[model samples]
Target: MAINARHRLPILLAAALPIGLLLIFESKLTKGADQVAPPTSAPSPPIAPTPTFTPPSGPPTPRTPQFAPREYACSRAAVAPTLDGKLDDAAWASAPWTDDFLDIEGPARTAPRFKTRAKMLWDENNFYIAAELREPHVWATLKSHDEIVFHDNDFEVFIDPNSDTREYYEIEVNAIGTIFDLYLHRRYKEDGPAEHGWDAKGLRTAIHIDGTLNDPSDVDRAWTLEWAIPWSAFSPPVLTQPGFTEAARNAAAPQIGEEWRVNFSRVQWTTTLEGKTTTKPLTAPINDSYTQEPPKETSVTFPYQKVVGKPEDNWVWSPQWQIDMHDPRFWGRVKFVK
Candidate 1:
């Protein structure tokens, strides 16, 4: 191991060279590992916070009616009608008959096969309505009060005193004078229920059939119906809850010159008499002439009649553009006159 100084120095230099080379290689490897290549794609945008969602407060607005609503000048009655299902009284002379009813779906549909007309009058005590329906075969089946009178040929009245389309009143009466009355907080489309228990208190209705009822053998003339609804019946019950007072209720009677939303509907069915059934559909020819012969004052009979083919026809004073009678937005306007 004890060599000359020059030889020993040369060996040491070789060993140091190898070690230095190894260290250089190790340093290069570490530098390459620490270095990073440019990203192939843009760094993902910083994740954005999800936005909060909110819902509408109420139902969407309904489409406007295709046709303009009809209007009527409801005049004050000098004398209350006798409420005998007859429009012959002098009190009705001042009131004008409404235009003939058309298909509930509007003028786009065919005219009603039979003629129908109505008139209105109001007094301090009661509101009067009279309707005349020309039917070839006057018939009725359901007679129970509050029964679905529309199941039979029926006349219906809808009234919205505030014109707000809320808390409206509906009264349906059949030829037999069966009454089905209810109150609605909103339209059926708005998920409102018919409060059948709410009734038109002190309501009076009468029906006069000109032809023999339920008899298929004879061609009947028409049926006239009358209603006298007391103003007090329209007064809503007083709410006893907080923020409520007796003054919250509307006046018993409408003030002069006030306007209200109103509409009328008639439901007619296709029917045939038992044992006299025909294969042909029970549709009457369109009566071009709205005029009808006067009643003969003959005795009427109630024979069994069977409903035949298609569904009932809905004829209305104001065309709904849709078959729905519950939408007060399409109802006609009635301005109270002195």
Candidate 2:
């Protein structure tokens, strides 16, 4: 055991030197790996995008109202007779009056049949309109000219000379000698008293009753009425044309054939079996004419007649009288027959 010291020293040095070298290399590798790499994290999924929101729409605009213009309907503009000829059986054959008057109410209780006829004629001085209502019983208790004529069985007339569906006129008469003259339109509020200067100038209405009108015992036969409307109440012509104002100075203000708004309505009442007066339609017992609202399916128009020359014309509302029936503008132009 106490052998040579040189042999033991060489073995120990070789083993100890290799072990220290291995430890130093391992420590350096661990420190270098920690400094280079970052912390670990899980991968994320892709996102979907969102859409924008919008609101809904609103309502639509309204439409304009229209009406039937009674232009050519008025006999004043017609070339035939011109509504100024003398009233005789010959001229009466051609007037626009309806023979079979109608009942206003529905077809439940028909009004008694009556003979109704009308005529129109004009002269150098005035335009004339007449109507004759032949009744079975002619009894009139009311005698006032301005009172309600339809309180008893009566006949009514509506005149829209212009026939523009606006600014027309209406009149009512009963067998009892009562007369109700009124202006009409699409509205009632626009109706007012006849104008002072706006006279039907030579207008006249005569009622010839056939029987006792108001007497419950006797029956009325018939009633007649005559009217003469002058051309003075129309609006003055604007100097819109040459010689228009000058021509109107001496000549009639409204030239011949100048039509105004006009229509006729007959409100007739019947004595019911219950001894009560009822509102009857303006139709004949055989035929009903009062239920008509006019032929609206067709277009309406009015033509101006050139009396002396084609004089410049003026209307109550504007270039031409046109408006909504429900509007007040139409009634304001009521010029009454004085």
Candidate 3:
């Protein structure tokens, strides 16, 4: 009975050892789980800040100011020719067409033709200009630089001495003449400025007539011209500039009231019936209709008293044509866009 009791005690000891080991392993596992338990309010990983959006810079645009172009009519009296250095009734009758005349400081006065006898004027916002070209036959070709294009019987205006005579502007047209504009440097006569550095902005020219062109034997109609150049392009340098001040180039800083030098020219050619093909030349025959320069009358002055509904206001500079009308360098000035 002692031996049996001793063996039972050994078995009980082995069973107890296994149970003790199992209890220790289970306690260690429970402690590890408690330490690593998912946090009830765990702090989320800091979120990166949202990026900001910004717009890119843009170009500047200036505000457009208000302007009023003093309207005027091109009536017969306003553009009457002064044959003998004065506005004479008899001279007006003798003159084929009573129109504004060019009287400059040049030497072409001996029967100075209408080619160089026109006046140019301007006001603040617009460069105002007018001309009355008298021609027996008026015709023009749309094609540019056509050889003997002047023979097509067109009007031409060449303006250089732009303020300082650096670059120049040239315009050609026929009675039905399509207007052709070109630019050149004062120094070079060829089309240099156009190729290199000269330009024209807002150029417009119109012709008024009493008779129809291309129809020979019909009495000539008085040709009239009207155009406006914007202050924005007064200066070729700052064509794209934001304001008129830059265009003014500090030259009196043309504002609402300013003026600038401008000129007008006409190109008339003599045509003869030499068979079907027209034969025309720059010079005219002795018996051809003669155009003499306006007498050295008076300088055209501006700011003339405004007479509502009267022709007085139409005169930009002075009512009388200036002595040096042909000199585009000294023609007239224009006020800024009001």
Candidate 4:
């Protein structure tokens, strides 16, 4: 097994070369492992705490109920009543009187000083209205027809046939039977003007005063009013609207079981009569600072009684909740019955 020195030296060199190569590869592998980056993962999300339920502190609040307008059943007259201010006609016997008038601003305000009630009847041709207003001092000033009748104590009737609150009719009459009738395309608050030119043709009105008129001397019982309004009187010129037809502009007699919106109002003013007085003129001053003689002074007296208060009282069949009467939404529902 012993070899020559030169051969042994060559074999050892070859073996040493293989061993050196292996050692170099192992060293390289060790260095690569140290240089390698560590495996990394995304940071975990923060854990959330559980929520606790807390009840409300107090009881729940209650809601207000919606307001509903009053209703009336208007009966039909078997026969037409005579256009007299008296309610003794057989046609009005079946008609029931409306509730006593209340303040226009509702029951929250003071009640009306006098009692007022109205009844309604309808025939084939006309709509009838009868009112009995118990007033101690009955007086009126305006006389001309179509003049502002409300200037004097007056009774007013508002009718919305279709209950649309538009194309309504208003008729006002005073104790003297002076009438102021008008038509409105819409409510006055909606910037609509009163069509004074529109008159209720074929309209009949009568007034009867149980007490002396325009005389404050004695206490009077009451005044009564009767109205026979033709159904044709409601037809005016054709009025156009967004969803209205030509026939809708013209009014027709209401059929049985139909409903309409209606309201009545009474305007009363506080008045007093001033006694006539005579005054004598004083003699002109001795020192004449005036260019001409001092004007003679004479007594002056009003021919009629004077109104003491600035605003008149407004009594209505149904309270409007506000002072405005043009809002037909608050009017009572009148159902026509046979």
Candidate 5:
């Protein structure tokens, strides 16, 4: 289902009581600035527009969020681990894992068919994230770096160091180690796109598959990945022309007490075999994300031969209570710990 970026839950306006209690209610009442209230007719002045004020930070989100943001404390790694996908390093012995992911629409809706969990460990040089995703059929085609990796079964990371709802980064990777990294200026409501021009320099990532990839016959267990993002790499400028805030400019590294907005997402798609080569049709289960109904027919691969289905499942560390990942209000908080 496609969520309308412009759609916003309207604020509930308070009902007006009886006119006798109008003044007692303390609601502001106004009169015309240049109007003559007398019986004698006089030329009336033009109406003026009520002024609107915008905050310096960014556009205001809904006063009442669908759910509260979750929080996790990322402990410091006593010994920095290697960038290999293998999470068997001694440094991970004491690192605690986050709770299993729920559907992007919170726990009320359908739960993800497979299990997904993640853990975080940080060093002075890099912010580390490790995830294990349970998938029976592991498949991927994209391999080129910076390509849209999410088109295939992928894992994603979203980070907003300043929590300004602006100037954030999203990184995605598939089982084959294909990666796509982009910088977002604000959110979709403010015309945010995955800015491909911005790059994550010196970012280190690796993936390990427990079973064969792109093989339909075999039953795969799970895929694990580890990402090490250097603090210097995340300092790139963003779009939206607002540039960076004081927090963003100083977000080179997290202090012990600092908190940053973070979230993890996993995309899984169901595939069907039509023939030896031509699988030109894909069928996805009907799942209403928020409000809009899922489209019947979706797009195919770049070659237009292999029909790639829409993501069958979306699992996140912290539920957004909606399908829109661009909304920063529901992102989980990652507190830096010594």
Candidate 6:
């Protein structure tokens, strides 16, 4: 969030609504604060794939104000992967991974420095998600669940079933399995600061770090994670279309081709690069619009030598155009499969 934020961090954000709606509701509703974002650079070349994975079916669908969100066809897990962070199960072998993450700001911005991607699956009991992150230094600080886990480099999930954009679910998990989960009544611009009281009940998550934690002395490989969210917990609806009861939604189960609005984010902060420059470039495309001045530099300091308020990078499964991720309308599309 410190670098290329769509909007500033440190304060709650209000997602931008169309001008017509804004004129009518802007002052009528309470807004937390003002926010902003930045300039572009020469784009990076296309991403190369990992030896074990293949590129997404085609060129990424072009993003426009009304472009269709990126889409993935999630297969049903014949045997759910064990929630052990290793991703050693057979189900994962067949599940196609998503394209590498892009600058949350969109194609016009610089691509992320590291490789990050995810895949999905489902069974009658839960919806499953697994992600692989390439990192040279694997580290973490948070441990308590529901605490703001994003302070450290982390992976996040946002889901808005039925796509009403409200009454959605979000979960953040760090390298060591620490978690922060919450439910949003609506976008923060409307009504939010989504309380942490409602947990992802029956949630199962785990992490496997490929390198030493806090020991930046050696080059690390990567980390992988597996998490599951139960259908029953996601059954509750603050509101829904007529005659569509909670029981009915659960009963239908996620059948092949059914779609849901989902997106993923990675928050990375710049740390010391032994003997490298102390002041790091802040234009390195980050998340949420916390990005600052033109070619600005932020001082990296501390136990980790990373700036306290600055993030190294903000990468995501689907680019959000601006640095904001709260606008679920731009989130990638997840379609179910057998």
User: Which candidate number maximizes TM-score?
Assistant: 6
The runs of at least 3 residues in candidate 2 whose Cα sits more than 4 Å from the true structure, single-residue gaps closed, are 1-99, 104-112, 184-186, 189-201, 233-261, 272-338
Model 2 TM-score, 2 decimals: 0.44
lDDT of each candidate versus the true structure: 0.65, 0.34, 0.32, 0.64, 0.64, 0.65
> What ordering of candidates by TM-score runs from best to worst?
6, 5, 4, 1, 2, 3
Alpha-carbon runs more than 4 Å astray in model 1 = 1-66, 237-248, 272-309
Candidate 4 lDDT, tens digit per residue, 172-282?
A: 888767777777766654655456677788788877777776565566788888888888888855556553333534556789999999999887654444222211122
How do all models score by TM-score?
Answer: 0.69, 0.44, 0.42, 0.69, 0.70, 0.71
Q: Over all chains combined, what TM-score does candidate 4 have? A: 0.69
lDDT of 2 by residue, 1-338 (tens): 00011010101001111110111000010054557555687766665432221211211123312222222223432332322222344544555553343322212223335555555555445455666666554444444555434333455545444535444344555543345554422233233223212223234444443443334454444556555555442332233343222122232533344544433334433333223332222222211111122112121111111111111111111111211122222222223221
Candidate 3 local distance difference test against the native? 0.32
Candidate number that wins on TM-score, 4 or 5:
5
Worst 10 residues of 3 by lDDT: 1-10
What's the CA RMSD for each of the models?
37.9, 46.6, 44.7, 46.0, 21.2, 13.9
Cand. 4 Cα-lDDT: 0.64
Tens-digit lDDT track for model 5 on 1-338? 12231121112212222211101011011175888668877779986542322222332247644466777999999999766777889887678888899877677656777899998999888898888888776666764667555556688888898877676888788776667777766575565544666667777777777776655555778888888888887774634346433233654778898899898888765444432332112223222112222222444432222333333467888877656666677779999999
Each candidate: how many clashes?
0, 62, 28, 0, 0, 12
- Pick the winner on TM-score between candidates 3 and 6: 6
Backbone clashes (count) for model 2: 62
Model 6 weakest 10-residue run by lDDT = 21-30
lDDT tens digits by residue: candidate 1, 4-108: 110100000011111101000000000747778777997888965423222223322454334668899999998889767757789888889999999877776
